[model samples]
Target: MDGLTGLLDGARARGAFLLRSVLDPPFALRIEDRAPLTVVALVRGAAWVVPDDGEPARLDLGDVAVLRGPDAYTVADDPATPPQVVIHPGQRCTTLRGEPLTSTPGLGVRTWGTGPDGSTVMLTGTYQLPGELSRRLLTALPALLVVTGDDWRSPLVPLLAEEMSRDAPGQEAVLDRLLDLLLIAALRTWFARPGTAPAWYAAAGDPVVGPALRLLQEDPARPWTVAALAAEVGVSRAALARRFTELVGEPPMTFLTGWRLTLAADLLREPDATVGAVARRVGYGSPFALSAAFRRVHGVSPSEHRIGAATGD
Candidate 1:
């Protein structure tokens, strides 16, 4: 798979938070949900996304805006609009004073709003858990990335709006998959714009480094070396190293080590995963070897990392 696809493969949105927000002209919502990622699409009318640290961006119909979070942001009819509702972690809606507003009557299936016939309408999907998105992919995004409707064409906005109101069996799973697709589409479109692709993404199109990267991602558990990777990709070790470093901004082996450790860190978060098993799964020869490397690179032992993740320390 290509690098973008490989990174996106990790996005398994389990019961992802989704909603169709309908609001009147004078409305604002302060979102402090701290979700890892969120996609906001304007279905009707227009809206403004005011990120905590970036300039406010206006979204017209069919425009999609991606917001990276853990930091709070505001969505409103205008950048100056005061927030009337606050969405907390777990998507709990409340008034400004922490009074629960979740029971405030819903507009429709998976739909909520200030009024029934509000002027602005938006569809939102949030990946609540950090694990739902790979760190590799998240790191490549800005705090706020917008794909204007004029830049690309996609039918996902309408499709998602239709599916949001469904209540059939396995519907949650379907929405999750749909959200994933929408995210991928938006990102692919964003990255395809001139001068917007990340280094690794650009490197994926290089003849010499592309195949080598695929091999590494497809079989990260294999015992791989620069020379071996070069041979497998039909190039000399020195040549491959130069091309890979130039294009991807890292040596092949260095990149492979980071990829393995990233996989190990994610695997280590599972309750049933033991250090030895994770080590073996990520190409280390033994638990001790993996532990040393992990500590050196991440400044934590496998056990310590697991404990911290568990306790949210």
Candidate 2:
């Protein structure tokens, strides 16, 4: 798989938190949900996203903003507006003093806000993704990034907006899939802009290195050496090493070890998965060897990771 696709593969939304917020003027919320990733798309009127550590950005109609979190931020009619509500973990909304804010009522399915006819209409999708694979891509994002509707054109905003209000069998699953697609589309456009994409993502397009990367990702279990990879891609071993490092910012084997361990780490999250089986699947000959490498990189053994994953640590 290509770099972008592989990174996004780890971010698929399943039973994601979806909300359609309808707000009138003079509304602001201090968001501290600690969700790993969030997407906000404006369908009508406008809003401002104020990051705690960065400049505020305005989202006009059809605009989308991605917020990488754990850090707090604000969304409001104006950047200077004081937040009346605080969104804590579990999406619990309360007053600034922590008392539950119960004045606003739900408008409809998956919809909540101040009023039903509020001028500012926006759709929000929050992904509380688990596993190291998700963080692998999220770490590349800035605290906040905005994609203007004018620059990148996609019908997902409207489509997702339409889907948000539907109430039917398996509607949650449908919304999750739509949210995932919207996120993927927005990220693709955002990363395609000049110099915005991560180095690894940018390198995925290199004619020489791209094939090698595909080979590695496609069959990470293979006992791949630098010379074998170079030969498969029709390049000298030294040339492949130099170019792969130059483009992907790491030597091939270093990257492979990381990929294998990332896969192993995620696989360990499965309750039925054994350490030895996971080790073999990711190219390690034995559980002991895989545990050694995993500990060196992640500072934890596979069993420890599995326990932490199970307990949501």
Candidate 3:
């Protein structure tokens, strides 16, 4: 656990702070998000986002919206009309008077942060590094969390403020990690408190299903059978099947099959491998069988995936 904990310790990512504006009615966070996701807790006013293939959603103060993937969206006041974009990161510090990523009804303060070189506004001062309890508490948290409103001036608030400032040696790394933990803690609290959607974060502390999930994710290609899995994990097959379906919204076997094929498709994209080789690696007996399943799952054949990968699609 220590080695794995330290694995992502040196994982450096860039942080940015830009305040600019664009004239266009439809505005958005144009720049690609960092490898690490961006967490924004709007301090003032409101924001709205139109996700691709989804309905427009409004965000209020104390609301934290996250985009885990790179998809262009229109964040606006009205869904019918485009909103002006301003204060986008790209336009900030650029020579040209670039259009803002999002329109600002008025000048607002947004604290944008990344690895280093990112500006973090500290409203309060002081941070507390508790012992093993803190680490355990952090690990028990959900993936995303938002703490908002007047009551934010709690003890954690001052600690967060101090963590934002460069006051101690190695503090940058320490504070960054602390912030990550704090965010996780806040999110965990949110999930347990309810009104949250059912997402991956909901799997945190599920007694029966969580262990099974860890197994599947850690070894997607395992020759997992309902009986084998149940026996290994010290549960009856019926119980494992019921619990998996309840938490994951899919049966154990179904999830395993999809995960195996996903890995197989990835291997098929490798320049060195033939379709036949990828099939064997993913538990398929032959190229024809793999192709049938691939086409059924992905619409495209393995060959097409290879072609797309080679052509930079």
**Against the unseen true structure, what C-alpha lDDT does each candidate score?**
0.88, 0.86, 0.48
Which pairs in model 2 have colliding backbones?
Answer: none
lDDT of 1 by residue, 1-313 (tens): 6677777676778789999998878989999998889999999999999988889999999999999988999999999989989999889998899998864385878988877788889999999877677767777788999999998888888999999988899999999999999999998999888677777778888889999988998899899989899999999999999999999999998998988888887888787999999998989999999999999998999899787655434
By lDDT: ranked, best first: 1, 2, 3
Error of 1 at 91 (Å): 1.0
Candidate 3 per-residue lDDT, tens place, 23-87, comes to 22233333322112344444334555565556666655445444332234544535665433332
Better of 1 and 2 by lDDT: 1
Task: Give the backbone clash total of model 1.
Answer: 0
Q: In candidate 3, what residue range of length 10 has the lowest lDDT sum?
A: 124-133
Candidate with the greatest lDDT versus the true structure:
1
Q: What ranges in model 3 sit over 4 Å off?
A: 1-46, 51-55, 60-64, 67-73, 77-204, 265-281, 306-313
TM-score attained by model 1: 0.89
List candidate 1 stretches off by more than 4 Å: 103-106, 269-273, 299-313
Residue 242 displacement (Å), model 3: 3.3
